[model samples]
Target: MSEWRGVAQGCAVIVGVLLAGLAGAGIWIAVYMQGDPQPDVAKAARSHTARAADLLVTAHVDQQLAQLRTALPWATHLGTTVADICETYPANTGFTRRTWTPVMCTRTGTAYLAFDGDFREHLAQLDTALAAEGWKPTNNAGDQPGLVADLDYTHRPPGDATAAELAEAAARPNVATVRYTLPIPSTFAVPPGAGGGPFPIGTVEVAQAPHLPTIDDGTAAHDLTLETRHFVDWQPYSHTQLSTAYPAHGAILAISVRLPYNT
Candidate 1:
């Protein structure tokens, strides 16, 4: 009986030792499966960078729109409408290939107010206003009948580096550059006798750098750019009887801002 008790105690000790070994092995395997941590750190860095870029771009866009609102109160109309007509045709062979051409026509109309008085004076006024805000005239085609001036401004955002770190890390390149045009007339050409032909249209454009740095390994960076046309007033006569009623004014703003990484 004593020998049997000894054998049972020994068996229990062996089982405990085996269980402990297995638990340790499991832990080691789990740690090994986790792989390198550097990739995760890089991913976090990219996410931070993208978020920073997006915030910078949004602020810049808002500033541009605000300036526009102040400088051109007459530009009350700002929106866009699109019309598409589709027709079907039989397939045909051409150049040893058979294909059917898509039958669709899309028309977009934008309207906005131009300066009511001397356009040149208005342009000068706008230039002065923008100049006060650090914008400069990159090109001036004011002599042209329809086009006026092109203004450009560069803006840099605060860097991620701490103040104690190298200033070079904090000194980033231009995060974004905005180019806007001041036109004497509208971008749209109203048909003869259109009710709203007298009003001028103006346009603004914005373009910014990508959210992430371009990689040499063939990865593409996400960028942002957009153009908007602000109209003076609506034109009801331009629409056909079957068409929907035109809004009170005609304008369109298309804005796109892209960020590269997930948070």
Candidate 2:
């Protein structure tokens, strides 16, 4: 009977210890909670840096293209006037944190008649202008210097190119195409604001879109096409290939600038 009583007292002590431990834990949690209120993320502004980066890069594209227009008044814009997009990425591999970066693309083609005299001088001048704008010319494709403009018959069928047209394209290979890159110094690490999860892959929520002078008629649509070919295609800009269907047999230049993001 005494042994039974001792066992009961021991069990009671064990239960009391557990209850005390639980109570301490609860008190600690309450104190921790009291220290800082949960952030009212609802009131926070959507990332200014993300949007600023978007606008900055897009403006860079517009400015560069306008410069090109000034240098070569007769130069024709091929494809979309420009592909200015800010692509979102997960800062971590777990896809919890989000960040965004901007990429701008543009292409221009000139007439074959003007290719000989005007193209060379104008292209050099444009290069100088771009260099002044903090864009460095790179011959390395891996540098992701943006897109290179060229006569692209790859999308067309094998027999799509006639022997004469191919010869003509080959004969006039004086088109000057250059790619440029603008290195971004800041990391665009955007916090998850009032919203949860990152922005949709193909969509850009830029506040400055309405006030912009020129409409981006080509980039989003081409991005959609690219999404089909390669799922969630972050890079819509590539070799700005002028198809045989489109007669762009002049000076060709493609520019791409990829923004920085947190890893």
RMSD of each: 23.3, 13.0
Q: Candidate 1, which ten residues in sequence have the lowest lDDT sum?
A: 215-224
After the best TM-score superposition of candidate 1, give how far the Cα of residue 138 lies from its true spot, in angstroms.
1.6
Reference-based TM-score of each model: 0.28, 0.35
Best by lDDT: 2
What digit string (tens of lDDT, one per residue) describes model 2 on residues 1-263?
99999999999999999999999998987675444332222121134543455454445444544554455454444433333322332223432223322222222211111221354354445555555666665444332331222112212223677887677665554433343445433323333341323321111100111111121324445535332121112323223333321232433443333332211
Please provide, for model 1 over 187-228, each residue's C-alpha lDDT reduced to its tens digit, 9 standing for 90 to 100. 222222223222221233321121211111101111111111
lDDT of each: 0.33, 0.37
Cα RMSD (Å) between model 1 and the true structure? 23.3
Kindly report which residue pairs in candidate 2 clash with one another.
none
What's the C-alpha lDDT at position 124 in model 1?
48
Task: Give candidate 1 misplaced runs (Cα > 4 Å).
Answer: 1-46, 80-115, 140-263
